[model samples]
Target: MTLETDDRAEAQPTARPSRLARVRAGLPRTGLAALCGALLALSFPSFGIWPLSIVAVTGLALLTYRRTLKQAAWTGIVFGGVFMFWLLIWIDVIGYDAWVLLALAEAAFVMLMAMGQAAVSRLPAWPLWTACLWVTQEWARDRVPLGGLPWGRLAFANTSSPFTPLAALGGAPLVTFAVALSGALLAAAILALRARGRRAGVACAAGAVALGVVGYAVPLPTGGDTAGGPASAEIALIQGNVPHAGMDFLGRPMQVLGNHVAATEALMAKVGEGKLPQPQLVIWPENSSDVDPYVTPEAYQLIDGAAKQAGVPILVGALVDGPDATHVMNEGIVWDPKTGPGAHYTKQHLVPFGEYVPFRSFLSQYISELKRVAVDFSPGDKTGVLQVGPAKIGDVICFEVAYDGIVRDAVTKGGRVIVIQTNNATYEHTDQPDQQFAMSRLRAVEHGRSVVIAATSGISAVIAPNGSVIERTQLATQAELEANVPLRDGLTLADRVGATPEWALALLGLAACGFAVWQRRRQPK
Candidate 1:
């Protein structure tokens, strides 16, 4: 009887061992997903290992392959949470809680994206669907609760990569699609290879290589006079160092304003001595004058003096008290040497919570930090295409550069050049400056116009139409950059198409997800 029982036990399968194996299998995927997130973060500026972005995307595609909805969602959380936490670590300067909450909220979008990715993984041309989903996620995230934060985009990582020229074709969305598609194709190649499908693997691999190198074939006008005429403008960018680094970088009431005035005066002095060519217009960074020039006489006098000294128009970024007592305006004012503050562009996209609290009456009761922003900032009704001197330039203030619509509006509305006025004193010495600068480079190529960035506490640059840096300033330095940038009136295909590619690609992704669900339902139980 004992021998018979032993024989039966030996023949029976062990349920515990099988369950253990399943659990062990899940751990590696989770670990790898986390690693993928970290790698993606490193692909961004400061760390800037561009190829890592493609690798991370490939790993994510493989992780979600054949995964259940629940499994895919969990993998996304692991990946997105890790990625955002590291990418926005600079937010910790505000508060650790704020950083965590923002990271969690951003990761939620990625979690949903992962669910869609998993759903579509079974479809034919799954790699294409996956790439579209990436664009869809960015589209949603770019405009949502509080004008969604558009940081950590895949296109931003490829600003200087071979895929950069693709920006001129369909803007940032197309570049993102190319990168994501390449990574997905790599994943497909890997899967086929492991399955011993040599022909399929080779085909997928070739497809990825083709996508990666095809950008070089695209024509990008980086030469003189992109407008088909001998038209160019001499521009100057001013980087006025702050008194100190942090939220209080402005220091004394007129300290920040004085720094900018001093820098402008120094540049003018150089021009006076014939050390440099006279600029047609000079661009100052956002918050170069924290106090409203209209409300404060001292600030007005200082700015007026600097503009007159330059003997040209100075695009000065300032906080102007306005529309109401409770609201302020962040504006880029054209201060001509003859006429003080002629035309101005009010910043359209205001930074939520930083510029204004969303639910002041309710949230302020719980979070006392909201008290710091005593007054709210109002949004502008029009695009920032203003005539500065002889050039019609588009002015995007600080974080506004990250928004595709804002930047595209300027170009489509007859902006000859692009100007980015930023103040990075609060986030100085962090990856934020480098990331913003990368966006400027991409914008140059996207619109086929010269991009001039003026940043307080540094990273001022002059970017060519082809995304080359003609001049750049270091962080926390008081410096001036002069460049003869070409004036391009003709818009790229991206400018003409606007958000069509993004919307179409996003819709396709959603359709794939729906079809995937329908397919699963049609299957037998």
Candidate 2:
């Protein structure tokens, strides 16, 4: 009887250890997922540890491998929540609640993406499918929940990385795919190494290395005098200081306008002294004139005087009175030295709560913040490829730079150079400006056009066609930057292909998920 009791006690101890071992295994995966998310956030601007993004991706792939769909969903929640909350901490400037809600909303999509990725993990060529899944998530997120928030794409993180030139071939979607595939390949290598399959591990490692270095071979043409070739235009970017940061950035109505006018006048003064070369055109930040230049005579005179002083056209961003009393328009007007305001490009994509609150009556009842945007800003029907003096420039205002279709429309519609007119005052002293600036660099390489950014409260910059920053300004400072930028007319492969690659890759990912479901159902339960 004593011998029997000893056997039973030993069996009980073994059972306890089995449960403990399973719990211990799960704890590491959860912790690793959170760590990976933080690493991915660090890959973005401000920290800019880019290689960490690949490492994070590898960690996620390994953690999710062979996971149950439910388990993968939990992993996604942990990873997405941490990464998005970190990346969008700038939204806390509005409210902590707003920041949390936005991060969670974005994370829900990542959860769905993770479920799809798990489904495909059992399929052959899963690394390719996993890469496609990343594009699929981005494509969907770029268009939903009120025109989507595209702040944390993989392509944005790789703006200056070797993966950037792939953007010239297939736009942002391809760059994202390349980054994801490289990381997934690395994960495959790791799995092979753990299994003692040395040959397989070496092959996977080689593929990842090949993918990382392939962008160096892509030819990015920057047609200019520097290349001893075609057209180039000398342009000036003006960044005017704002009164303060936060929601009340445009203090005292005309104060912001005066700041910009003073900066432009100073720029022309330098030209008069021969200290700076004369520019063919001057670009001003969005909200340079908060008052309607067309309706307000003082605003008109202020802009006209600056253009006259510069002896060139000024792309003036203004808040114009709309057709009705309750609405306004965000427009970029071409104010020529002689012609005055001509050929204006109104902002097409309007910010939901920031520009015009959606479901205003319902949402405003709960959130008092909706009351700030009293007048709804109307959207423009046309693209912003306007003739600004000597150059046919694409005018992408503020957050419009984040949209693929908006920027592509301008490039396809005969824009020789791209000008991003933005106001970073509201998001000053945050990583938001740096993040947006990185997008401009990617856009420059994507469309193969010189990108000129003009920002209020700073980070205004001139980026070359090769994704190089020619000139930039300090945040919240009154500064003027001039760069003789290339004006390229030739269309890049990305421009010509448009959204084809994104669509193809996205569809393929969905198909893989469908196949994975079918495969699972066919299995013996």
| Top TM-score model | 1
Q: Estimated TM-score per prediction? A: 0.95, 0.94
What residue pairs clash in candidate 2, if any at all? Answer: none
Candidate 2 worst ten-residue window by lDDT? 1-10
List model 2 lDDT by residue over 199-231, tens digit each.
Answer: 989998899899989999999976653332338
Residue 159, candidate 2: C-alpha displacement in angstroms:
0.5
For candidate 1, report its TM-score.
0.95
CA RMSD, predictions in order: 5.1, 5.2
Show model 2 residue runs off by greater than 4 Å. Answer: 1-25, 225-230
Residue 63, model 1, lDDT: 86
What is candidate 2's TM-score against the reference?
Answer: 0.94
